[model samples]
Target: MDMYTFPFDTQTCTLTLKSSGYSDKELIFADVNNQQSLTTESQQNQTMGEWELLNINASTTQPSNLVFSQHCITYQITIRRKPMLYIINLIFPVFCFLVLDVASFFMNASESEKLGLKVTLLLSISVLLLILNDKLPSTASQMPLIGKST
Candidate 1:
């Protein structure tokens, strides 16, 4: 899995089914009634936690080697993360803090009080950064855009 795009990323996974002992002549995989082998109704009713199912494509392949040929049924599934959760839990709070930080300049207060409020907001933003770090993979090839912004 690639984490460069992170919370807003779309992922495609492939699943292949084949019988090692049976050759293409002996075993065949086909969709019933020329319809999708997997039912969308069943997939629609199921929830994938943070990921939402976007598309499913099914195809058949016959790979021949020196020994024998095997029939394989492959399913390619595309899913996207439900970003609303991250936006609410991570982004919204940081945005609110920034707004407050800007508003603090307009408040009628002592210089020390404004400094203290700014410091508090900075600390709060750092805490949110830690939370974001925990959610991202440690060994990602490139940092996500959201992470880079933070």
Candidate 2:
């Protein structure tokens, strides 16, 4: 599929529309999950679906505003993937910091011991962050590429 970007923000995307018996509200009622593919042959050849980024202002809600018209009934697709580098970078260093914090508790307390232990813990955190940062992929990708920014 060609890269697509919605004009605006939309919580949901509905697909597979028909010119007849199609209601802006009711169309969302169909079980789009069972739908496998979308075709616009005999269909209206219009947009049966829409790109949210295309939303003009917040006035339009239906495909009428989004696509001139739409054909095709509906289709279903699956989305899946593993945790991204952001997730790894976020949780990994935080996890290591916590581990180091817990480790600091094991140190014995004394005059020089207290000073050394605090310095050691701070150094450990810094080192852990450096190690964690190094482990992350370069080029600096954005966070939560899907939903939210971590």
Candidate 3:
């Protein structure tokens, strides 16, 4: 899984097939590329809300039968979300505030007014950070890149 996109990511997962009751002598997969030997697809229950299939590939591996050697299939999948509202609500205002803060540097405000502007911006940014703290995954192994940039 490419989790760098966290909450919005795609993944390639593998499914391994093996015979538990019989070893390679009794039960062995034929040509791994043969679709009939592996799995089948049903059109009725195809897609899910968060994920969709992109492609799939099948392959065979060398038998190393301590317990059971396995055949494997790889699935390529894409993740989907409805993030328009999230971007508009959480990102737009902060972007506007940052732009305004940059513009304020060139304005001809007095020293006291300029200091007040900076302070106001700082407070707003702090509030945004606090709010974002709750929205982000606390158990994430590392800080999110978006949070680092912010």
- Highest-TM-score candidate: 1
TM-score of each: 0.79, 0.32, 0.51
| Model 1 stretches astray by more than 4 angstroms | 2-5, 25-28, 32-39, 107-109, 137-139
lDDT of 1 by residue, 85-107 (tens): 88898879988998998899898
TM-score of 1: 0.79
Which model, 2 or 3, shows the larger lDDT?
3
Cα RMSD for candidates in order: 2.9, 13.3, 5.5
lDDT of 2 by residue, 1-150 (tens): 211211122233344435565554545444333222322231334343332122111112235554444334443322222234445655666667678777777777654676776787788777766776664334423332332435
Superior by TM-score: candidate 1 or candidate 2? 1
* Cα-based lDDT at residue 25, candidate 2: 54
**Each model's lDDT:** 0.79, 0.44, 0.61
Ranking by lDDT: 1, 3, 2
Q: Model 1, residue 75: what's the lDDT? A: 79
- Name the TM-score of candidate 2: 0.32
| Residue pairs with backbone atoms closer than 3 Å in model 2 (clashes) | 6-53, 7-53, 7-54, 8-52, 8-53, 16-73, 16-74, 35-76
